[model samples]
Target chain A: MPHDHHDHDHPAHSPPQPDDKVHSYYQILGVALKELLIEKGIVTADEVRSAIEKRDQITPAHGAAVVARAWSDAGFRTRLLTDANAAVAELGYPMTTTRLVAVENTADVHNVVVCTLCSCYPRELLGLPPAWYKSRAYRARIVHEPRAVLAEFGTQLLEETEVRVHDSTADMRFLVVPRRPAGTESLDEAALAELVSRDSMIGVAVVRQP
Target chain B: MRGPHDVGGLDDGPIDPAPHELGFWEKQIDGLRGVIGAKVIVTTHENRRYVESLGDDAYETLTYYERWTAALSRQMVDKGLLTQAEIDARVRVVRERLAASGELAPGAEDVKP
Candidate 1:
């Protein structure tokens, strides 16, 4: 492997040791660029801080809200699948200009997302992707071996089921709306939304009954 | 511009199923770039192209946000916000301050191929 998945011998995600002053070029570059931009009056520090916080606040729950609503309301589902940008906006998510495509995972078919080029995700809807979602392993393998990768994520499909991989790009993002699990008819919209996990929405796993 | 970063459908290593929580510095980089990108000074397309042009080694060594930060720096410099010399000087200063403050990360200067 040309790349070391482990970062700088820090035991898998250990807290930054106190002497962590040695900065990578990116960190230095980030600080430098931020400083210059601020000095140039191009952007304010508070502006950047708030933007990050907003973006960081997005989670699968946002997507789950949409999905759970869709499950209860067929009209909303049609709107989401037909025009994701407008539908998501109705719920207050301002997405990129790139269109969002909602792929339905039915009994015979499944769906997943990846940006084979460089991790182009729907940040407005799903927040930032996981590290593995952007890994060389996933970008390379998921499209070709969707079943195998899905297995790794604990998603086992029936022999008759079909797996579909959505290749995200700069112009489009794919969101998987997994099938509504069984035995939850009595559950309310909020409760149903709680059953939807990020992994399930990513098409790597199924929403489980609770 | 086409290289290893475009790894869709290629065989590679195992997926780390860990939850990738962003740290403060990572959030700062994202925040900074997000603010800059919003100004229309540098489009997301241009920034992504810059990141892809970083070659396989740096792309592999750096984390996702690190690449974003590096590419943001390059684009900012290219966009006339900073000269290469100016940013270089700033990097040096950051290093000194960090070292003096006992936050000096060891071997951070080494960029291995």
Candidate 2:
């Protein structure tokens, strides 16, 4: 589950809300391009509408389910680590654009993903990436100092624990399967999935049972 | 030796980590990119290349989707999918309608067509 997640309860931060009253050059351009394309019969209006609807349906929960399954089943975890794309597809969450690489977080090593060039993300399973993921500070500094970035997210790792950062590219994406919290072995898959957050899947925050 | 977009390992400022709800236009632009990619009108790589080529100025000034909108406009022209004149004309029409309905931003008209 590298791409989209449908759940809207983002972990943290409050971004400025878009003002519908103001329309800009690019906004008008976006509208015009879609209209012109539809006017020319290149694509139907219905098609574009449907595409928007479909995008809205995907969210981080999709990735959480995948992580939960991997936590509960060792065989599935093996398959997920071996062939993440096919493993997710078997769960009915197929990769639409890029190849998915599920990186597991062990007690000795923690993994995180970022796109240094641009906002390359697993949009299918993780839904849209958070604005912070696209910010210059996070992009530039994460690779340089992941522990600091992780600390900002309130994730503190032991000194001996290794931090591995994966830079997502145009053709490939990364999803982090966080180590399940202790004392959660009695929980079912559904309950386990509830504990996985978007930030955890992005490797910014670790999964913690409440 | 780094491109404007190659910001990894730079001593940039602290991350805000704020998550804002996307605007309608932002989401629309994203959907347009998705649909256009599905149609094979433009490859995702091409879009990334175009956005990366937007230089330091645009990368600094525009928001995420604004960069995509601007780059997509350039790609459409370069690919001959649409003419600049046609885009401008449609924009003018839409702008006029919005203006008439008093929906334009307070000083959005200050920007050139």
- TM-score for model 1? 0.91
Alpha-carbon deviation at A7 in model 2, angstroms: 36
Residue range with the least summed lDDT across 10 consecutive positions in model 1 chain B: B104-113
* Top TM-score model: 2
**Per-residue error (Å), model 2, residue A184:** 0.5
Winning candidate number (DockQ): 1
Q: Model 2 chain B — which ten-residue stretch has the worst lDDT?
A: B104-113
Put down candidate 2 lDDT per residue, A168-197, tens digits, no spaces. Answer: 998999999999999998999999999999
Residue-level lDDT tens digits of model 1 in B1-113? 45857777678767878766676778888788777777778777888899888877777666777778777777877877788899888877876676677665666644322
lDDT of each: 0.79, 0.85
Q: Pick the candidate with the highest lDDT.
A: 2
Per-candidate DockQ values are: 0.56, 0.53
Per-chain TM-score (chain B), model 1: 0.87
